[model samples]
Target: MTKPVRKRARETSGGQGRSRPEEPGEGGEEEAVTFIAEQVGALRKLAERHKLDVLHYLLGMTKLEADEHLRLRSKRKLS
Candidate 1:
């Protein structure tokens, strides 16, 4: 029979957040948002080239939101 897994004190303890552990160099949420911002910038350029005004505008907004998220996270860490 298979045994059930158990949680450790450090692994539990209410912990504020970060319940699920991540592998090294996998680049967590912040990295993901930064990557999204970079990609959105490139996509916005492509949309502009294709004369997609609405699409370009949407991508610009998306990039701004991602940037804002990073900014807010940084402020939280400072606090």
Candidate 2:
């Protein structure tokens, strides 16, 4: 004769049931943060690979503005 098996109360009575730990929600926030970080990193790498034209345009505009400021300063010195 063999002895029958006993299940713990924490386990579900249904067949083929899955059990989870008794606590607060799982670390879903951490997983979301990790996923967002990976996406941002991929975007940064893509930006680096494709060299944004807008950035170059902005830099050119800044240089032009600085040249105008210098020209005005020189004109004021001559007056």
Per-residue accuracy of model 1 over 1-79 as CA lDDT, tens digit each: 9999897656454457644666786888899999999999999999999999999999999999999999999999999
lDDT values, one for every candidate: 0.92, 0.56
**Cα lDDT of model 2 by residue, 1-79, tens digit:** 9999997776465556444433575544334444555555555556556796565455445545555665676698799
Q: What overall lDDT, based on C-alpha atoms, would model 1 receive against the true structure? A: 0.92
RMSD, every candidate, angstroms: 6.3, 22.5
Candidate 2: worst 10 consecutive residues by lDDT? 26-35
Q: Which pairs of residues clash in candidate 1, taking residues 3 or more apart in a chain or in different chains?
A: none
Error of 2 at 12 (Å): 72
* Model 1 regions lying over 4 Å from their true place: 1-20
TM-score of each: 0.70, 0.36
Residue 76 in candidate 1 has what lDDT? 100
How far residue 68's Cα lies from its native spot in candidate 1, in Å, is: 0.4
**What is the lDDT, from 0 to 100, of the residue 18 in candidate 1?**
47
